[model samples]
Target: MNKRQILQLVILIIVILAGIRFYIYIDVLRSGGDAGVKTGIVEGFLPISALMSLKKFLLTGIYDYIHPAGLTLLIFFLIISIIFKKSFCSHICPVGFVSETLSHIGLKQRINKYLFHTLTILKYGLLAFFVYIILINLTVSAIESFLNAPYNIIADAKMLQFFTDPSRTTVIVLAVILLLTLISKNVWCRVLCPYGALFGLVSVFSPFKVKRSEENCTGCRKCTAACPNDIQVHTKSRIDTPECFGCFDCVNARNCDDCLKVTSGMNHKLLPYVIAVLLTLTVAGAMTAGLWKSTVTNQEYRRHLNVIDKLSH
Candidate 1:
């Protein structure tokens, strides 16, 4: 398969993995492994843990920041953007995968494209209404409920039961997103996902962009045609537009199928992962060191008590 097809398959796998992981975690917790999470590691390198701590942020507003999922997700996204600008959304995002696949089969008709574009604006509106405004006014309980309500009650707890319930709206929404992806194209990500909105906002700052090399341009318009996100690749001077998802389909250097010769390069920055790795290491080290020190001190105190009892005897 071509790069695009390969990327699509990868995205499908990631989505499936994420769903399964969440499911398994919930089941494991229910099986009474609640206090058995092995989060601490040597020098603070958590192979499977999130970059930052969102579990605390989600479970309680106090925000101790244990195993932050959201912040780590954002950091990981930055690394991906650095390698290939917005490629995560274009190539990996489950929602994007759904939409692109659907575009090929279900939304191939002209009317489908028009309808998809028109309705996409609703996603933006929903973000503005629900996330920016409503979430702040409500309590954490309310926020959790809303987040999990569509799937199950979020109340900051594991949600396996929600998935088990076929009648639940949470399952329905996920089903709808998947169904629409096969039928429509990235309908959820493009139009409704507040998380995408958040990422898009930061992605505006992405440095590595797809640019058109004017000299090499025998603009046959294949790039424009091949672009799933519908970017005008031939004429645009700045290829790093917000909508551009860093899928390098137009470049001639990487592959021959490219419509025009494009000079795709990075900004002054290399991989966004550089910064994230450093930050993650620092935080992870600090957490490990701090916890380890405390554990050692407690053990020493216990030893001292035993010595004192032996001396008294």
Candidate 2:
């Protein structure tokens, strides 16, 4: 495997381990046993809670105690996007790794460029709706109310339950997405993930970008063909598109090294490692600051778990 794939695999394994630990912790709680530790890694899945927490933090300067890691991770991802242009999707996201793997199966097909572009709008629309609901519509009181709600307190457990015991509708939707991804490359990341849409929007201001040297170009179109995001790399001297994942597939595809390069003195091969280090440091910093773990007591978790099914958003 390449460096990028290796990094992604390592991250996926770590996340899986964390998920398993989290499941055992929750299962112990459900059985009225003392689950000594609670893993906060699952908080990464609670983006909506993180968004609400972000709003509260901005307004009052008080960080979320219930799921502080969620907000920390959300902020980390945004900062990463601003500097690295969606490197998280290419190098860290488990879902993105799964989608990439699925894309290698079956007959790889490409949707018409026009239709693909049209479908890409769906993610942006979903992001806009979320932005409106969380950032614009909700008042500070409403945000605080939701953040402290019983349902929100146990959202991580709920999310685990969602996958461990998925509803028929959820199963069907996931199956369809998987099937689509098998036929077409990165269908979910390219067209439907609101998280990716958010990152792509923020990445527009990133200083680093792919630069093509026309003088050194052979017009082989290998760079364009190698782009998983369907970005037309050969036709443009500079790729400033938000959709660019900074995967450097195009750069590696070039016949000549100088034909394709990243701007701002960044080495393409070292970029993924840089991202991995930054992610590690970010999580470490949060842990040092006592912000990586939830402040909710084990007793509180047990109390919430007892009525978890009765809680609603």
Candidate 3:
């Protein structure tokens, strides 16, 4: 199968895994006691805690116990961004899959160029603000306090409830975003996701890129039309845009035999296979190293779930 189809399958697998994790939590809640299964991978939704843990790790060399999985997941994605150019977003992110699916419901309508630029900048601005807040305010003690807070201990439960029992404001915001995405391809990923912006910045340093052969000499602009980020692919000999997701749609769009390809010193059609192997090994290594799960125990989760139950009601 082609890369796009492979990416869709990957997304489906991830979504299923996430669903199973959420099911474990819900089962525990329904049992009113230990159901004997807990999945820390769900903590990946807690990006704020991950950022705090990352800061603590940098300053003190202490790996975060409170949300170890979140921190590790964040690190894994950053590594992918460095090596594979934001493949996490294009190939693995469940939310990105949802956005892409929604955006494909109809033909995409273009927004004003000025408005599009402003919206694109908003994500970077949000990333900058978050970085500033985390860097300026974070300390070892602060991290400890935040991690140990009752609210944080029950955060996963709350996150689940946030979707299953969303507030009116949450419903409205999500509806608006979904509507926007239906009209424009990847409105959230391209214009409003801080995580995407973070990966975009890191991907700037990646050696891998889509390089065009100038001598091939066809400027059909098919690549530009296929680009979700609206990058001008036909004009450039090399695509160095941090906005590039390395989705390979541009390369695939070109009918010319040698006009375009994703390369790093050499062309390898099995690059996706290499990336998949690397990703699988990294996750497996992290699990075997005992860094995949959080330090929180079933007893702690039981107590935390009680608190979450109380808070929700």
Candidate 4:
């Protein structure tokens, strides 16, 4: 199969795994049992806690037990970005998959050029704000306090509530975003997601890059037109744009095999296979090494949920 097809399959597997994990967690929560199995991957959604854990690790030299899996997954993705140029977005993230699927339903029109240029900086701005808040405002003590807060303890439950019991405003906002996604390609990832911005920053240093062959003599601009990120692939010998999610749309530009390739001192054709093998190994190794599950017990989780329930009432 082609790289794009292989990537789609990978995305599907991830989405299914995530769905099953969340289903089991929510079911266990509903059953009111301390013995219910929980999925630690759900903690990945709690980025705030992961950031606090990162700070705590830096300051105390202690690994995060509160949400170990989340922090590990975050680090894993960051490393992948450094090695593969944000393949996590194009190959693994469920949100990105959904966005890509929705983008297909819309007219293949670009966002307005002027507005797109202005809005593209917003994700970076959001990333900067997060950096300032986490690095500047949080001391070791502050990080400890926040990570151990009741709200933090029950954050997974709270996230479930956000979806299972969404308020009118939440529903409306989601609907609007959905509608907008059906009209624009990757609006959220391109303009709003700070996570993507962080990955993009790390991806700039990636050795793996799309290199255009100057000697091939094809300036057809198909690569540029095919790029979801709208990178000027025809004009540059090497695409170093941080916005690139390594989708390889440029390289996949039909009949341009010799004209474009992704490389990093190795065979570019093995890129997809390498990504798949690395991703599988990372996840499996983390699990076998006992870094894929939280230390927080089911009893502790249930107790925290009860407290949150009482507070809400």
**Candidate 4: RMSD to truth:** 2.6
Please, what are the lDDT tens digits per residue for candidate 2 over residues 147-180?
9888999999999989999999999999999888
Q: Write the per-residue lDDT of candidate 4 for residues 1-313, one digit (tens) a residue.
A: 4575467666677656865677667567657744455677677788778877887887788877777878887888888899888877876776777777777777776668568768979989988998898977878888887877778877877877787789999999888878767777778888888999889999998887998898993788999877766678888888888889887877777355788878777665566677778767876888898877777777777778766765431
Each model's C-alpha lDDT? 0.48, 0.88, 0.78, 0.77
Per-candidate TM-scores read 0.58, 0.97, 0.90, 0.89
Better of 2 and 4 by lDDT: 2
In order, how many clashes per candidate? 10, 0, 0, 0
- For candidate 2, the lDDT comes to 0.88
Candidate 4 lowest-lDDT run of ten: 304-313
Candidate 3: lDDT over CA atoms? 0.78
Please say which candidate is ahead in TM-score: 3 or 4.
3
RMSD per candidate (Å) reads 11.4, 1.2, 2.5, 2.6
Best-matching candidate per TM-score: 2
Residue 278 deviation, candidate 1, in Å?
10
Residue 281's C-alpha lDDT in candidate 4? Answer: 88
For model 3 the local lDDT of residue 81 reads 88
- In model 3, the Cα lDDT at residue 31 comes to 78
